[model samples]
Target: MRQHFFRCLKVKITKFIAAGMVVTCLFGSVSLGFAAPQPSPITILPIDRAKFVSGQLFDFLIEVKDADPDRIQVTVNGVTADKYFGKGAATDREASLATYRINNVAFKKPGKVEIAVKATGTAGLSTRTVKYDVVNPVAPKRAKNVILFVGDGMSLQARQMARILSQGITEGKYNDLLAMEKLSNTAIITTSGYDSLVTDSANSASAYATGHKAVVNAMGTYANSTADPFDDPNVENIVELVKRSRGMATGLVSTANITDATPAAMVAHTRKRAEQNFIAETMLDPRHRPDVILGGGSRHFLPLSTPGSKRTDNKNIIDEFKKLGYRFSGTKSELLATPPNTDKLLGLYQLDNMNVYLDREMLKNPKVLGGFDDQPTLMDMTQTAIDTLSKNPKGFFLMVEGASIDKQLHAMDWQRATYDTIELDKSIAIAKEFARKNKDTLIVVVADHAHGASITGTYHELDGKKGREAVRIYANAGWPTFADNDKDGFPDSPSPDITLAVQYANHPDYKEDYKFKAEPTVPAIMANNKAIANPQTSGEFYPGNIPSSDPSEVHSADDIILNADGPGADYFNGVMDNTEVFFGIVRALGLDGNRNVK
Candidate 1:
């Protein structure tokens, strides 16, 4: 009886073990049949595509949404910014937020900057990453001095128009040539930044100033999370590097405000270009301060108590410069009469942009700043900058920008844009003349970007029709008849018997009145956060091709022409990237002082 009972117990135990195995297999199959719920949306924009300069400062940020803060993790090339930048990150756990920012982090050697951010939540898991290439230091060839001339929005067609108007073409032949036409070296540079195909003046100029490309409206820095424009990672600019490393003098001259995008890029770094007030203040930084600064927009340097000042404080930058031994001149005569031997010069001719060349020198239009009657031309500013900078025995770097070409184009004023192009050419002429005497100077004439303006043939009032109907094209597209009999280097009248019919590839719907406006017209204005054609115009309407959000014709992703002369200029041959311009300038100056402090 005992053996029979033991046998029954063993059978019961075996049966229990078989039942447990069956239950386990069933649960495994059920789990295999179902999938996890999808995670919330997440986006990652790569910042690592650029070839970053070693030891340069940049931002490291990761964007993630719908994930719990406690579950998010960030790593830079497998390391954290806490370890890279030596700063601990703070997270908002209560708000379900996660953010990691590393400012002024330096890449010690040439390689790659790979960033990985991983997040997991109740929904699921996701990851995003970016990689950046770092390059070894390249030693530049020796050059005594460098002059960069920026023709704001001056494209090849603009150059052609200026040549036709200023030089007068006779039956396909030209009478003389533009001053920039005789450069010893030439190259076609493709201009674009990391963020977009088309770049604004600030970002494009930043690429030239710092051997690195930044986003639109940014100068010498990249966009990162933060409301403070001053907090962006700073890249050492030519103004700072040249002065600090080689003791070289630096100067910036422009027809627009000295704090304008093109000129400010040399010393300022901010994600937003509209921060002109802050940029003006940054100009006072001892690192990148210019030896000679000449331009318009004196309002920014004056105290807020001053009626026309643009500053929000009583900083009085003019007084600060004067206290620092700079000769402050506010007029053409004052700039000219100031002793050339003065080591520092600061000239501000107007509270706003200087008068256009046509108005300042020829037409004498009284509408814009007529009170400042003696404002100097771009040529005058260029000559003065050269004279002041040349006083430095250690050599100098001067950047002269004719900043109105883009401004007039934005206003849809082709004639004004043409005149500004002429002004830039004249500035180049001054530099070329100086180069003739001083072979040690490297002179470069180029545009930061291009406009979409093109010659749509000729438009003659004698065509017997009106507006677009009279626009001459194809076989009827005869050459324009712009004459310069006085040899003053400008057409006596922009509207000749035959004027070139230029059309904007991108613009708001507006009247096609083929006549140049005596006063500038605002093409579009903001209405309900959208740019609409100005309702206050008297001409027929034409629809816009670009989005209504744009108030004016937009910039094109077109290649720009770079003309160069003097030593180390040969590097600008063939088609090159925009960043290469900065390299060319640095290489010309042999700036390998390694201004980085560990």
Candidate 2:
């Protein structure tokens, strides 16, 4: 049968090879052509196979390279694009690049939609076709509230380290599992974006927020040919969907700068996550503005005249939020004093990213914390957000992030990163307690991406073995003595006699002392435009494995773990794409985005 199948539908191999045609196997019919198909020069936004909730707004764009200025046609399904969108395209052309863009459009119905683009270029006619899926989740029992926890750079190892520190193991058995680990449903989540193998916090978080993949350094939008960051094709995120569809309150809480990549992705749409100043201003846009905002980036919200302000323009965003009836808080005391009736709250504790839990709370080092010592814990911030957002009968969607896990890992400070992971774990416990009282709440805990840190074994200088020699492996490795003496979940001391010997798989040239830094120090320093081991450690030097341009470790492409509880979490099972998280949240809330958009 196989011989007969190939013999009956055979192509002239010589003739097809003479042309640039590609031959098909027995399963496909052969097509003889002048050339094998080439990739289209025109690019469409939303990418191919994008999924969305019906009526979720997004910007559509067609970018053409080396094309004639006036020769471009776009169609949606079979209808002309402009007519289909009920508006004409805003065309822009510069040099060899031209674009046809339509902003703030949505599919009113649930089904598949095709976008076809054709442009006349010097290389002749260039055509492209892309399809999208629109869905409307009809739930049996809806969750009135949803809380997402992102532990940035928290890989499986990162989580395990937190577990070991917070809940010690005895004879190869853990005494207690983490609060997140106790979740009913869990999944191994793939964390790459469309453009890169390894993703940064912004791109991964954007996938979680918008149900669409974005490139590194970008969030809430797709990249376009133009250089403008804000003008990129925008996608409606979870924040916007919950707002217009269900009148749900929204909150974004983080330990990093409030306008940083992970937190900002929930609300801001930009091709560059570094646009912190603009992100701070975009929060004022009522169409998708969050009801509660908490974090450590007061600099971006302050006016340019303020000494530590990061904005170039003299825009006082904090004052603007005040005008909009938001009670402002700059310290833990102020946050705690916020009126219980205050539904709108804005808290920015530090001028920059907040210090890690270790440095801020336990170490009490004035040098590390500077003057901003009154910062709130992740648990307190999340509790405050839940309290304020729940005031709305419609419920809310809140995103809480442990921002320093990634930052400390980048600096190769495993001790600090592990403490932040514990902090995130404790915060998850708080959210779980809230969900217990309100059965209509869903809680999700996940990592934006993984770091390259790994545990070789335990390290100790007890036997006079020092540096690399002190690293114990196999039978010599004993359990780390990380005791939670006071029952606060955190180890009494991070520098136990036997401590985790965490090493980086991908790292810059750096010093290795087999000891935690008393104060956080850069693993590498720039010397003559190249990274070199820091001299502060006074230990053996290890050469960098990655490019010299990066003095810190980079994100790993490894799959991350996600745990969830309450309604609709069962949707997450087996191996899943990162974008599915957004769908899971929407499904749990029964958010119906199918509506008219004007």
Candidate 3:
């Protein structure tokens, strides 16, 4: 009975197999009766033109399609990777995708870098080869200290206007040139970032300090697929590289908040410039901390319960710096009294942005000064910073920023802006005097961006008429009597009988009273997060011409002029990328890969 049952089961199985095969043949389908082999599915795009200096750190990325991360293989310059990317790579197993990010890798010898990547999966195989050309940088010859001066939001027109106002142009040529104009070399720098033609202060300054282009509002890091702002990969900054390699002192001085974009770019690496609290702490980090930090924004350093603190914790950065042997000063008298030989000096004079020159040192306007009665002048701050940093025997790198020029210009306060420009010139004059004495110091003056300001002749209110009808032009555009008999280098008052009737080429369609504002007026305000014409101004109602999203005057996508003096100045001429400024400064300081590489 058992034998009979076995025979019956075998006969049924044979019948079912034959029936299925006949059905497959009838449908014109055949099965191979074997599993298919997997194929590679990884590729790398060739870098036809990769611009980098020897020993410069850059990234290499690999993309694998339809493959597990564990199945991917990568080789650098034909070397068998023992450990790809140190440990491993990130992968999406269900999606059959993987990404390998290699950081701080560079070709020390100048040549072509060939990268090969292979990926295999159950579907198929893919392979890609990429070549990147590595060129050596020009070796340094004779310069030591490099000083970079940035005039925020200054443009060619701003420079021309400063020349006309300060040196007085009579019949086309009657006065001397401004100090910046007399530089040994001049270059027109293109200020666009990797993201847009128009760049903010942060990214542009980062490009100048680190020879890599970054996106708008980002500093020292590239935009990547990450939710955390601090986790993005970073490029080495001049402050870190110089101090680590040469043991040189680095100082950052600005009239704006110390945590503002331009100054903050030197040390902090973050995707967002508004991360003031994080940036302040980064400034205190021993590895990236600056030797001499003199500027405003003390509120971010103190904790919340400390009355005027802007921070959430009780870190007391002031106390931390004191513990670190930094001479902390909260007032001008303390700054002046501090001994010149002090190694590390940290000065924070105000809880916010220090008052501008017209308000703090000159006008003494209480409404504008806002009870922060005593603040250091640009001159005072520059002198103290120089005295402190110059003590380093290995030399120092100093970045001085004249910040409020753009702030006042955005408010349409031409007089205040001009005064701030004069103040910047004074600071440059001080740097030049120092550079003259110390021939090794390479000094550079440039602007991170430009504005829409122009000299459309001059404006005089003498016509007894108001608005555009009173605007002066041509021979009728007689010069206004702005006497500086005291030669203090500033007009006693901007409200003369004939004042500059400067009209903004692009602004909200508002009535023009053609008079100087006694107090700085808010040109625009925020309504539901959109920029609307400020109702605070005393004028006829005007609708805005720019996008409602913009709060005030926006940065123009115009090229800025750069002036340099000392050893490596010749490299900066005609049209050049903003990153070239970094290369020039590094060459001036003789920064070498062998010297700085760790």
User: Worst lDDT window (10 residues) for model 3?
Assistant: 22-31
Which parts of model 3 are misplaced by more than 4 Å?
1-50, 58-68, 71-98, 111-140, 505-514, 540-542, 596-598
| Backbone Cα, N, C clashes tallied per candidate | 3, 0, 8
Candidate 1 lands at a TM-score of 0.83
For every model shown, what is its TM-score relative to the native structure? 0.83, 0.94, 0.85
Q: Which portions of model 2 miss their true places by more than 4 Å?
A: 1-37, 596-598
Instruction: Provide the lDDT at 570 for model 2.
Output: 77
- The alpha-carbon deviation from the true structure for residue 409 of candidate 3, after best TM-score superposition, in angstroms, is 2.2
lDDT of 3 by residue, 429-456 (tens): 8889998998888889999988877766
Clashing pairs in 2: none
Q: Which candidate's TM-score is highest?
A: 2
- lDDT (10s digit) by residue, model 1, range 344-442: 888999898887887787777677656888888888888888888888888999999989888888888889888888888888988888888988889
By lDDT, rank the candidates, best first: 2, 1, 3
- Candidate 2 lDDT tens digits, 1-598: 6775576346456546656665554544445445646777888998999999878889998889988757889999999999998999988788988888889998888899999888998889988899999888755678999999999999999999999899999999999999999999999999999999999999999999999999999999999877899878899999888888888899999999999999999999999999999999999998779999999999999999999998998999999999999999999999999888999999999999998999989998998898988999998899899999999998999999999999999999999999999999999999999999999999999999999999999999999999899999998888998878899999999998999988999999998987888899989888899988887767778999999998888899999999999988778789999999999898899877774223
Q: Could you give me the TM-score of model 2 versus the true structure? A: 0.94
